[model samples]
Each structure stands twice: as structure tokens, then as C-alpha cells.
Target: MIKNIIILFIAFLSVTDLFSQEKPFWNDIQKFKESDRFNPPVQKAIVFIGSSSFAMWHDVQDYFPGYTIINRSFGGSTLPDVTGYLNDIVFPYHPKQVVIYCGDNDLANSDTITANEVLQRFKLLFQKIRKQLPSISIVYVSIKPSPSRKHLMTKAAQANIMIQKYLKTQKNTSFVDVYHKMLNKNGSIRSDIFLQDELHMNAKGYAIWKQAILPYLKK
Candidate 1:
């Protein structure tokens, strides 16, 4: 009986490990929850949700003074990841506005994924948000022209255009176009704005974002 029980326990451990591994960024979400439990977030603040771009912006609050900001971004995340974690990252905050910076990783993640798919995923997220918080403002930061992901620029542009068009018909929705602004006069991506990795941004890139996004924030 002891040997049988030990075997069952080992099997249970294996299953638990597998389940945790299956959930991408689970630890990140858990950490957010833990932080919220102790510190508590400011209700009705502007919440930023998405991938590494927003996550890397550790100083996002400093960029906009007098605006309450709650950033729940997890690095290396895709659109679906954000959608999957909406309960944790978004709704609970009862936010006044939501600023998103995603869909970049969705395209870069797989060749099989298309721009239209990115738009669809975004719509799903939008629909869910509207269903739960009907009156809240929504802002989408257009996927940046990352120097490292230059090959995927066409796909990114297509996704951006479609998302921008879709948001036009929705009330209280603003699409901030940072993609074109990040490009040079010759229409090339500005390499100076990116970090050494060419994937993430440095201060200059965030500065551009601050300008583009500031006007849309709720006072």
C-alpha cells in the first residue's frame, strides 16, 4: 500500500508540473495578484495591458503626470495571453481607460498567423471589455516598427490599419498611430529609438509613445 501511494503521488506531481508549464506567463499573473493583495491598485485608473513593450516601460507612470496608471503588462505575451488573463489584468481594476500595446508578438510568434487574425483577436478582447465595462475608454497603440522585426512590417501595418478602421466605429475608442511616427523621412524604421537588441525600445521610442498616447488619456 505504501509503494502504491508513493507511485500515485509521483504521478500527481508530474501532472501538476505539466499543467503549470502549459499556462504561459502564469507566474507573472500570480505576481500581479500577490502585489495587488498587499498594495492594492488605484481604482478607475488607466490600465495598460499587453506584451513586453508596455512591460519594459517601467517608468510609464512618470511619462504622464496627474494620471493614475496601473500597468499589468507581462513581457513576451501575445494577444490571446492578454485575453486569457483579462480577469486578472483588466476588469478587476474597474479602470477608467485601457491602453493596449499588443499584436506585435502575435505576428512575430508564428508565420501561420495573419494580420486579419490579429485584428480578430483584438476584436474579441474589445468585445469582452465592452460587455463587462461598457462605458470605459479604449486606446490601442499601433504595433511599432521594431528594427529587429522589420521583415514583419507589412503584416504589422495591415493589422494596424484594420484595427484603426475597426476602432473608428466604436464610441470612446482611439487608435494611436505610433508606427508611422517611428519611421524615418525615407520611410525606414528609426534604429536609434531601439535598445541594443533592436526588439525593445529605449527612452527615445518611449518619448514618441508618450506624445502619441498622452492626448488620448482621460483626465
Candidate 2:
């Protein structure tokens, strides 16, 4: 009986540990929830949702001073991850507009992941958002040409084009073309805009983004 009790206790411990394990970006989401509880964000603000590009833009609010911006981007997140947490980051805010800057990670995630697959994933998220908030304006920032991900550039461009074409068909949607703006006259990616790691951007890159995205903001 003593041995059986010990085994049962060990099994219980194992299950508890399993349940306690947090997935990627789970902590980030929890932090956002905690912040919201302490000091809630104003509803109907522009909610920027996506991966590290938007995540690293910590001063996004300053870029567009007049606009009420609530950025909920978590580092290294993909379209699927954002879609998964839409309830927590998006709908809860009742955002007047959602500006998405993702899909770069999706292409870089795996060679097997095609441009079409990325488009499909994006479409899934868009559909879910439209179903929930029909009148809300949606904006997609084109995947920028990162010096580190040069190999994936062509694929990323393809994905961006596909997304832009799709967004054109949808009502209240805008596609910001930062990809072309970030390129040089020679068509090579301007390396000066990237940080030391080359994956993320510097202030110069964000400035270019501001110019392209400013026109599309709802107010």
C-alpha cells in the first residue's frame, strides 16, 4: 500500500507539471492581461497586433501622437499565434482598427511552409476578425526585406503580394507597402535600417513605416 501511494503521488506530480508548462509567448499574454487589469486601455483605439516588428516598435504610440494606439505585439509570434489569442489582444479592446505586421516569421519558420500557406493562415485570421467585428478597419503591413533573411526575400514578397491582392477585395482593409519603400534604387535591401542582429529594424525603418502607414489610419 505504501509503494502504491508513492507511485500515485509521483503520477500526480507529473500531471501537475505538465499542466503548469506554459507555451511560447504565454507569459507575454499574461503580462498584457495583468496590465489591463491594473490600467485598462481605452476601447476603440488602434490595436497593432503581430510579431516582433510591431513588438520592437515600443514607441509606436509616439509615431502617431494623435491616434490612440494599443500595441499588443509579442516577439517572434506568427499569424497563427496572433489568431489564437485574438480574444485576449484584439476583441477585448474593441479596437476601431487593427494593424497587422506579421507573416515574416511564417516564411522564415520553415522551408516547407509555402507562400500560399502563409496567405491561407492570414486569410483565416482576417475571416475570424471580420466575422467578429464586421465594421472594424483592418490594415496589413507588408513584410520588410530583412538583411538576415535575404534567402527568404522572394518568398516574402510573393506572400505580401498575395495578401495585398486579397485585402483589395475586402472592405475596410488597407495594405501598406513598406517593402518597396525599404528597398534602394538598385533593388537591394537597405541594410542601414536594420539593427546589429539584422532581423529587427532600427528607428530609420520605423520612420519609413510611419510615412507609408500614416495615410491609412482611421483618424
Candidate 3:
């Protein structure tokens, strides 16, 4: 009976693994598709794609009045998540410009993921975007220094540096440094910019981001 039970347990594990492979984190993408069905967004819009930071930006349109904007950010997602849903969230819109705020979640989501690994993921997204869009301008927003995720700041800083340096090498790519601006004079994270969760940014934080990002937008 014990041997039979072990075989059954192994079978259960196999079934679970198969289920996981068949179904990815796709519910959010489905909702976006549904929303688009009823209220289709304009094509060639500026798309802000990333994790919770962009997801929580409720007043993002207010920040930039003259520009056409679309926020396709999904909170609790890493770089792979964004790339995974490229067909649904990214390419469908035919974005004129793509602004990204990821990598922080990549490090915070998994302890084993190295900064260089995060850099590689970003590079993949970069290459894919350039290949697919060709003439589309891209912007990489540096990861913010948050009080809650201070422990992962080292990796975050490294990922930012790597991505920033790489953007310098590519044309029509810009790196907005919200990281340095989010730091206090003593080099600590400025807590006032974040909400009580100490992870997502508040309105004041978005204000600072607006100042940093506006100049880089295509005039």
C-alpha cells in the first residue's frame, strides 16, 4: 500500500507540472484584451509597460497632457512577464514609444536571480522591441529606491547601471534616472515619495518622475 501511495503522489506531481506549463499568468492579459474590445485605445500611442509602479500610476495621463498615452503595466510582474505577454499588451497597440520600469521586481521576486540575469532579460526585451518596431523610440526608467525593498537596492542599482549604459549605445533609446533622484542627500531612499506600503510611489514621487521624464519625450 505504501508503494502504491508513493506512485500516486508522483503521478500527482507530474499532473501539477503539466498544468503549470499549460497555463501561465495570463488572466491579466485577458482582461486587457476584454477592455480593448469595448474601448479600443488609439494605435501608435506611448505605452508605459512594467510592474506595480506603472500599474499604480492612476494619474499618469494627467502627468503628460499633450501626449497620447497607454498604461499596460501589470503589478507583481517581472521582466519575463512583460515579454511573455508581448503579443497581447505590446505589439497589438503598435506603440510609437515604449517606456519601461522593471528589473526591481525581477530581483525582489527571486533571491537566486542575479543582477546580470536581470540585465540579460532587459536586453532581450530591448532587442525584441527594436527588431519588431524598428523605428519606435524606447525609454528605460531607472528603478526607484524604495524603503520597503531597500535590501534589494544593490542589485537594483547594478541592473539600472547596466541598462543605462546599454541604452547609451543604442539609438532612439533614453534612460531616465529616477533612482538617483529618489535618494536622499545622505544617499538613503526618500521615504516621502512612496506610499505606506513603502514600495509603490505616491503622487509626490510621480511628480519627481514627471520632471525627470518629460524632457526626454519626443517634441
Weakest 10 consecutive residues, lDDT, candidate 1? 13-22
Candidate 2 Cα errors over 4 Å, as ranges: 1-22
Which prediction has more favorable lDDT, 1 or 3?
1
lDDT of 2 by residue, 124-206 (tens): 99999999999999999998899999999899999999999999999999999999999999999999999999989899999
User: Candidate 3, residue 114: CA error in Å?
Assistant: 1.7
> Considering every candidate listed, which one attains the maximal TM-score?
1
Badly placed stretches (over 4 Å) of model 1 are 1-18
The whole-model C-alpha lDDT of candidate 2 against the native structure comes to: 0.94
Number of the candidate with higher lDDT, 2 or 3: 2
Q: After superposition, how far is residue 186 of candidate 3 from its true place, in Å?
A: 0.3
The local distance difference test score of each candidate is 0.95, 0.94, 0.88
Query: Order the candidates by lDDT, highest first — what do you get?
Result: 1, 2, 3
lDDT tens digits by residue: candidate 3, 1-219: 999999999999898778656756566676788999999999988999999899889789999999988899888888888888787788989998999988888898788998789989999988888888989899999988899999988988888898888889999999999999999899999988888999988899999999999987764
Alpha-carbon shift of residue 9 in model 1 (angstroms): 12
* TM-score (C-alpha, index-matched) for candidate 1: 0.92
lDDT of 2 at 134: 99
Better of 1 and 3 by TM-score: 1
